[model samples]
Target chain A: MGGFLAGVVGACAEAWQEVRIHKGRVLLSLIGVAVAVCALSGAVAMSAIAQQATIEQADSAGGRAATLTMSMQPSDSTATGRQQATQAWFDVLDRYEISYASRVFWGSSRVQFPDSVQEAGMTVVDQPYGEMHRTRMVEGSWFQPGDSARLAPVVVINTPFWESLGSPDLATHPTVTIDGLGGAKAVIIGVYGTSSWDTWPSMFMLTGHFESLLDPVQAAGSMPQYEMWVPPDLARELQTRIQAELSGAVGAQGFVSVDRSDWGAQMDDPTTILRVITMVIGGIILLLGALSLVNIALVTVRQRIREIGIRRSFGATSGRVFFAVMMESVVATVVAGIVGVILAVLLVQSPMVSELVSFGGISDVPPFPASAAVFGLVVATVVGALAGLIPAIIAVRVKVIDAIRY
Target chain B: MSLIELTAVTRTVLIPDADPLTILDGVSLRVEPGERVSIVGRSGSGKSTLLNLLGMLDLPTTGELSFEGESVPAMKPGRRDRVRGSNVGFIFQQFNLLDGRTALENVTMPLLYARGPRFWGRERIAADILDRVGLGHRLSALPGSLSGGEQQRVAIARALVRQPKLILADEPTGALDVETGQSVMTLLDEIVREENAALVTITHDPAIAARSDRHFRLDRGVLTVAEGAARNAGRADEPVTDGPVADDAVAVL
Candidate 1:
């Protein structure tokens, strides 16, 4: 047992010395492995951060707004039925103590700016409440209550509308004409910003402003669209109450279609898809890195054939040679793994990397998990052992007599 | 009792796509404890082959060989290796001292292979052996850094370090100059005498053969006693001349 231990120590010392003497080669090999590990870990970290950011953004946007769409017959021209439906919804919401903003629905109409005319789906709201239906203004300002009753109608336009209109300074522009609806001239009161309405061109106006453009009879016949915001936890109860009251007052056909913002649900969320792709890519890179380590260990063993023979000649048994070579490979791979983990941590912490992640909409850097490091080390060691097996066998099987002759 | 015994020992070399070649042909020899013997032959005369067979590095094709009266031809490989490690020491023609190791480490190698744990006391044993071989000052120097004569002395130190019962040297001084070779031979003789170990040195150098207690000539797969004038003739062929009477009276066995 003592002799075996001594042999192992001697072999380890020799292996270390050889590595030291060929420092350049060892460093090169280590760099190969380190780069592979860094790429893998960096990719996983970046993808995870990006996915988390996207989910957070989606939740923030979707959680705040509650919408309900109702389908009515196109020819249902009775004001009594629309009024009853509106009253029923209002009473249900009031019963639940849920504060909501309502928008009267109108069909699609085109709005004309000086340089560009865009078709914007129109909706009329009485007032903004609970920060839920309020659009943030990028330039100019939101419509004031005083502007609601002005002779010329005041309208709020989204950013895309302003940009499409050649970015004109429409802040002081008193009035603009709408080709459809009533063809009345409307005043541009404010410009708001949002990525929420990216799908189509859209703008907002007060119910009075919209009513001013339409004839009294036409306005009376038009169905009003309503959008409401309620706390997410109270949503189910609120929805149930609205449905019950609307069905009772407006007949069995009267029903509310509650729409919860499902930004992530659409297209399965690109960020999550990207995260899964990045993870697969990272896993492949790690596997290649492990293979490279094995190749290096095998080559080292082949190169040390004569040395192994000499050790055997000195009375090292086959088992001893096998263990010594395997130990050397494992030690080398573990060292590389540690260095790789350090480099990965440093890369993730770098200012440039963090900035890039933030630019991709991720604000927080994920902490380097201890589990990842442990897993990497264990994998590297196993790769080392696998790589060492064949070579170790060859080393042990060397004939003492043939080795001395050489 | 003979320290080494060989009965009808034969070693053959088998090569693919070639006929089998016999290197040692049913030759037999023996040496008692404390006896210094030399086997002299030309190149390829089976001298080294016989040495290898005796050293347990090669197995005989059809013969029973013994070391210290124990049958070695039939021993297991592990047992053979153990016996070779503990009971037999070898000096090679090229001075096969591990080039990377210091002189002391080279000498201490056999002891390091002992079944027991190595202790600090192994260093003392190595030091003593190095001192005996007149290389006390060069103990820390690697074999490659040593001169040819110094390296040969280190090899001799290594061979004797285990205190083996038998020493097998194959042309131990074959690569050295006349002066260095003489010093090396003198050192080998002195160590073998002091340790009471049987020494069997195989060389083509007749002068070295004459210096031993008994000299045997190997030629054409046969061993023969070279005595009287023929033994002196072998001595006269020495690269360095010394002690003409001793050379003339040397007996062959």
Candidate 2:
């Protein structure tokens, strides 16, 4: 066993020396391998970013996974009836210890500037909406525990909306006056970053605070819907329970409908197709790279025929000669793999790639995955072994007498 | 016991569309431990074929050959390789030093397959042998940087690094100048004697052949020793019994 290990170590060292001696040719032959590994690992790293973008898109359209969104259309869907329905939904949410819940209501607020008035887009949400949607606060903070206890309704406005309000400082407790809230003032408690679609001014206010000052005609046109987050495994059962309980509380038979927002299912269909496409492309690149490597290794072995003969005469067995030749390719490719992976990290983790992926939306760039690096190196070694096989056999078949004659 | 013995060793090659060509016909020789023997031959003679057989690089057809009392033809190829690696070393006419390797690295090549502490301490052993060959200062020099005689000296160091029982020199100084050839031969003779190893030198020069303890000639695929050369040698106790002995006009050593 010791001798076997020594043989392996000696062969590896000799292989490294051979590579160093012929580095120019080795580097030329290794270009294909380096490019293949770079592309493969880069694709792997980008997949994570792609997946995150898919989840974010799904979250914006529907909601995150394990979230149950309930909607109802009752015969007596009056303002008072809607208030009763919301209260009953809240009771059910509190009973289940559902920490995240929001009633999404879109409305336009009449914001009065110093010189003129403008109608700006506003979203009414509970505190958890900020976290569930991966919203980042640019200043101050999301709704705190005592935020709802303040006299004026606290609203988190985007940068554009804040700028429309003359860029008031949050430290001085800036306020804005709205038309429909009986000329009441709204406090700007926090400022959040803007998305690409948020061209106009936008603000996020508490559901109850917005509802208190909402216009009845506007509320009638767009009804508020309740969404809540729960554990994924318990989502289906809880959805059924919530439907039954909300129907009983509101006395609205066949009106309540509960559905789960499955982000994983939304992600699987398209991403699986993407994954297959990626594999096909990566496999072709690797195949071409292997073919190139095989060609170069064949030529290299042919050129080293005399050297092989000399080594055999000096006590190297045919097996040793074969192994030494094969290991030269293996060692060279492994080093190239390391270089390619480092290049991949630099390429995939760059700010330009992140900017391209985010598209000025929510910046949710994930860390470069370690699996990609491992996969690249393992594949490189396997490719090296496969490429070197035929050449090593040819080298082993060389006759010592014929080679010495040369 | 003799370090190597060949009885009626014959080597034949089959060519396409032609009859089998006999390369070596009934060649017989024996070298005891620490003995020096030489074989002089013409260009097309069977000297190299016999040398290849003695070096264990090729097996004889329809002949009995043994090294240190072990049958060479009966051993497996892998076992033969091990025996040859551990017990036999060769010096080629071209010096045959690896192109890009240093003198120390070339010398350490054989010790990679040796057994015991010698395998583990190969670098030290190679360095000591290179120094003994007066190449200690040129340990890091490649073969291209060294002259013909210096490269042959490195080749000799490589051959002796394993301390084998038998060293086969196939025209060791064939590529060198006369003066350099003599000096390289002297170095080889001194090293072999100091190490107590048997030496088999195949040469085309009569002067080189005359320096050995015993001299033989190979002509037209047949080996013949000069008259009365083997009579005073120590191996006369054994006589040819397995194959046809040479005629009275020729003595087989």
Candidate 3:
């Protein structure tokens, strides 16, 4: 054991000496390994963070909630009449004790504020707990039951609508005019933030106020869309009850849409796909790094052929020669890996990188875990061993007689 | 007992695009402990080949070679390495000191290879040997930084560090000028005498050969000793010059 330790120490010393002698070459090799490792770690951390954000968004959007939507049909006899269809669906939900909200979609038209006029789509809701009103509000207050009677067509605008109106002070009293079949008199009451329908301008108003603006014929002809949000325990029961009752109601189209919240389901997911891709790319980079290491080791062995023979002649066994060369490679790789990981962390943790990624909805860069560090070390060591194998064998294979002769 | 013995040893070489070459044929010789012997021959006369065989770096194709009554041909590579380390030390013509290491490090290398607690103080042992060889001031210098004579002295220090029973020098001073070569030979002779170790020096220089206790000539695989020279000479024996051929007559026995 002592001899083995000595051999290792001697080998390390000898390798360090050689590296010092050719400092430029050693530095260049280390740089190559460092760059490769940095790229690998950065890509891995980015992918992990992106996937995590996606899952969080999906969970917040109610991945498991069940919902039912009802729309009135204009072209049917008594069975498809718009008012009758909405009442039929409400009755079914009430019978089943299913929690639900009704939304009446007014047609898309221009909304006018004091300084600006913008195209907006308006959806009328009965309560704040309804699906559309459940959107997170960035500023101002939500509507109450008396807001429909006390205020004249009060509106809750999204960020885009608020921004288009030159960021008006909606906290005091703000009014927006909506141009429907009736003249534009809609008022901005509140400002809210939402991840849904991010590309378009939109606003929300109380269902009673919106109904007051519509003529009896237009209100009867316009379909009142209803959305039923059911808890997991009552979801199937509510869906079945609503479907049965609404099939026979006037103006009922056989359920215009049935959906649960899936806001980020399609856009974001975390799985083995990114990991596999990273592994492949990282594996290729690692392979190239190993090849270069082997090339360097082979050159070193060739340059030291005479020295190897002299050592062997003095009493070094073939095993000792092999071990000496392998140790050099392992030391080089391990040092390079450590440097690479540090560089990667610096890059990912930088304010610039974090800020740039946050614009794309990712706020944090995940840390390189201990498992990753261990993996990097193991990869470096294995690559070093593989790279040194040929050179170590060559060193031992040198004939003592021929070496002396040379 | 003879420290080195070779009987009917033959070494052959097979080369591509050519007939097989016989480097050494049935060469038989023996050197007892504390003896100094020189093998002299022209280039390609197999003198170095004989030295290699004696150094245990190469194997004989036929017959038996022994070191201190143990057969060398039957030794495994590991055993052979042990024997080479413990029993025989070598100095080469080119002074093969590792270029990356300091003179002291090179000298200590053999002791480092020696398997025992004795190797623990190898640095001190190496420094002592270097001091004895007049290289105490050059211990920290690399081979490339030293002159040829200084490098050869370092090599000699390395060979002596193990305290081996026999020293095999293959044209140790062959690359040096005549004056430097003679000085190196004198230093070797003094060191060998001081250590009480046998020395087998292979050289083509008759002047260097004349300084040894016994001088033999090799020609076309045959080793012949000088005729009138005594087989064993006392420390005070005078140099003999009955011509080089006189060495062959003594070996006829």
Candidate 4:
């Protein structure tokens, strides 16, 4: 064991000396490898951020992972029929002990404008809706549990809706009037930012307040869908169990259907697709880098024929010579790999890069993945090993007599 | 036992789409410990091939070969290489000094493969040997920065650093002027005597051949003892003549 360790240490020292002697040539090859590793590592790190942005985007559209949405059709178009459906919703929630769930109603609310009254999109939801959807707020706060007890409706408006109302200060208790529905006043408690795809004015309201403003006939016509956040592990099994349980709970007064509505349940998950695409591109980049490195290493070995012969003539065995040649390349690339990883970390963590990769949406970009940096170094070592093989073989095959003569 | 022995040793090479070429024909030679033997041959007369054979760099096509009573041909390549490394030291006409290394580093090459104290104290051993060769001041000098004689002395330091049983000097003085050549040769001979190690000098120089204890001439792949090839103690080459460095060189050794 001691002899083996000595041999390895000796070979490494010799390799380092050779690398230092040929630094000019080593530097050029290392440049190619460094750039390749940087690009590959950056792509991996960026993918992590892209994945977070994609998840939040999906959460906004279809809610978080494992969120099941429930919808019901009433036996009759009457206020009592809708109330019975809502009662069934209450019973199921109480029985399951689920905490994060909300019933969402989609409609438009009449707003009093300076010149005339206009209709803006509105959603009637319970308090848990904003938290479940990762709703980004530009001002004020999301709906609180006590919001249900307010005499006047409390609403969260999007930027455009707030702009239509002159972007008022929430501390002053800004209110928008319901022009067509008995002229009811609604407090604008918060302003939520809009995604790039969203431009139209929209607002959110608590279910009780929205019902208080709109008449029973109109409230009965608005479609309400059930959503609840549950443990992802139990989602599939619970999805199956909920379908049967809810069907029985609502009984013959309504037809109920339950389905997993998160973007993850859908067939085309953009985040997974992004990861696969990045890996394929990164792989191609590394391969090109390795090929160039191998070419340069082969040329360098050919130039050192006499050196190899001298080492052999002294007492260097085939294994020692082979390992030394290979270690030279390995040492050079590992140093390059470290440089590349550092470059990648700095670039990925930079503000402009983070914003660009997240599409300007992800305020909390995920921390640089430690796994990505480790992956880069590991891959560089592997590439160095592979690139060194042919050159090492050529070096060991140098006949001592021929090399000395040359 | 002889330090190295070759009986009826032959070396042949086969070329693609051509007849086999014979470089050495049934050469036989033996040298005991502490003996100095020289072989002289014209260019391409198989002196190098014979030197390579004796150095274990090439296998004999057919023959009995032994180093200190161990059959060299029967050893594994790895074992044979180890035997060669531990027992034989080679000095080239061109010096073959590694270009970018210091004189001390060049001398440390053979010791890198050595185990125990030799490997650990390689630099010190190298420095000591360079000091013996009158190159102690040039230990840090690269081969390119050194003169021809200085570079050859560094090569000699490299060869002897391991203190091997046999030293093979292939045309060791072919690249130097006559006086410097004799100076280097005399230095080499005295060191081999001090170390009590066998020496084989392969050269075409008659004066260099005359300095050895015994001499053989190689002609067209055949070995024969030349007339008047025996070592003579009072040879004209030994008196230094007008060569100032010879006195210095021999005196240092």
Superposed on all Cα atoms, the candidates' RMSDs to the truth, in angstroms, are 9.0, 4.4, 7.1, 5.4
Model 1: how far residue A269 lies from native, Å: 11
TM-scores (chain A) of the candidates? 0.58, 0.89, 0.63, 0.92
lDDT value for model 4: 0.84
Which TM-score value belongs to model 3?
0.72
lDDT by residue for model 4 over B1-253, one digit each (tens)?
8788888788889989999888888777887899888777678889999998888888899987789998888988778888888888999999998879999889998888888888888889999999999999988899999989998889888888899889999999889998898899889988889989899999877788887776676777777664465443235333212222212322322
lDDT per residue, candidate 3, A37-142, as tens digits? 7666665665565555454444334432444455545345342355555666667767777655656565666766556666777777776333433455667867
Task: Give the TM-score (0 to 1) of chain B in model 1.
Answer: 0.88
Model 1 error, position B186 (Å): 2.8
Model 2 segments more than 4 A misplaced: A109-119, A138-140, A158-185, A191-201, A216-222, A252-254, A267-270, A361-364, B227-253
**TM-score, one value per model:** 0.64, 0.90, 0.72, 0.90
Give the least accurate 10-residue stretch of model 1 chain A, judged by summed lDDT.
A68-77
Q: Model 2: per-residue lDDT, tens digit, A183-254?
A: 778888898876567779878888768766767765665557788888888887998899888887666442
Which residue segments of model 4 deviate by more than 4 Å?
A: A110-119, A159-191, A267-269, B15-19, B230-253
Model 4, A243-278: lDDT tens digits are 787676556666778888898788887788899999
**Best candidate per DockQ, number?**
4
- lDDT score for residue A101 of model 4: 93
Of 1 and 2, which scores higher on TM-score? 2
Poorest stretch of ten by lDDT in candidate 4 chain B: B239-248
Candidate 2 iRMSD in angstroms = 1.6
What tier of docking accuracy does candidate 2 attain?
A: acceptable
